[model samples]
Target: MSVEHIQNSVKDVIAYLNENPQDALSNDPPITAVMEDGLRCRATDEDGNTIVTDMPQAIGGGGSAPSPGWLSRAALATCDATRIALHAAQSGVTLDTLEVTTDSVSDDRGLLGLDKSVRAGPLSLRTRVTIGAAGVDQKILREIVDFAVAHSPVADGCRRETPSKVEVRIA
Candidate 1:
């Protein structure tokens, strides 16, 4: 199935929220987390296991704070990375190394109800393109990147804010 594209500018997203306020903002499915060795961790919906562990010491929480939202960023970045690799190969562009770094600046206050500038989720993802494609020029690399951005499912998912409501039915 083709991925759905969301056309919501950052301002548009904010405006939509302003106009259509949620009854209550709550994370769905109640994603679980555990702290061990001063790091927060949690498993997935299938085969419960620790996806991330031993977070570095920061954010006042401990070794590190591996929140649910961070997972989103990680997942998206990984997806984009893989897609970039695949697209490069498919487009006949040979590459020796490809790397993408995604980052976001959120207000801790917004997350903790103390700061106003911090918004939920990553504010941005900066992708650095380094290609070692033989017989490929910068323009081709740029085209591949643009195509990857246009078609990357994770990129679209993040932009769409595709949060599943995920109701736990009582059977």
Candidate 2:
């Protein structure tokens, strides 16, 4: 889609929200993941798009699809890149290229039940964004980057901690 179209769509949404604040609330349908084989599973979204997940051979699963942890980091990086593009387009800054890299540290001991103190998930994540645009000043580019980071939902989510709970049911 054209940048102008995207900007107009965003404006429309903003106007709608201003007119009907209570209608801003929305929910996504639950996603489902099913085991396909040894250490392999398939996750389906509400639209029926499916992604396969698997562990490395060292972890006792076939070296097939990417691990969930890798996917999580990838999601964050992609989201950041997309938001940067959107914000740049809104600002009339045509981006020739945009990239985001994410780094995370984790302790496997927690996942393997080898250590009680170690956390099972990534302890921290860092993101780096690079953008290339013709005729754009360095200051403007920095502003675009700052705006993207400040308004990015994924970036906000990474900074805050959310509670998650799991329940098991016998079938």
Task: Please report the candidate that would top lDDT against the real structure.
Answer: 2
Off by over 4 Å in 1: 1-39, 45-49, 53-60, 64-71, 115-118, 166-171
What Cα-based lDDT does every candidate model obtain? 0.64, 0.88
Worst 10 residues of 1 by lDDT: 1-10
Clashes of 2: 0
C-alpha TM-scores of all predictions: 0.62, 0.92
Model 2: lDDT to the true structure: 0.88
* Tens-digit lDDT string for candidate 2 (84-118): 88888789878887889998998889889899988
Root-mean-square deviation of each candidate, in angstroms? 11.3, 1.5
- Model 1: how far is 60 from its true place, Å? 4.6
> Per-residue lDDT for 41 in model 1?
65
Candidate 2 regions off by >4 Å? Answer: none
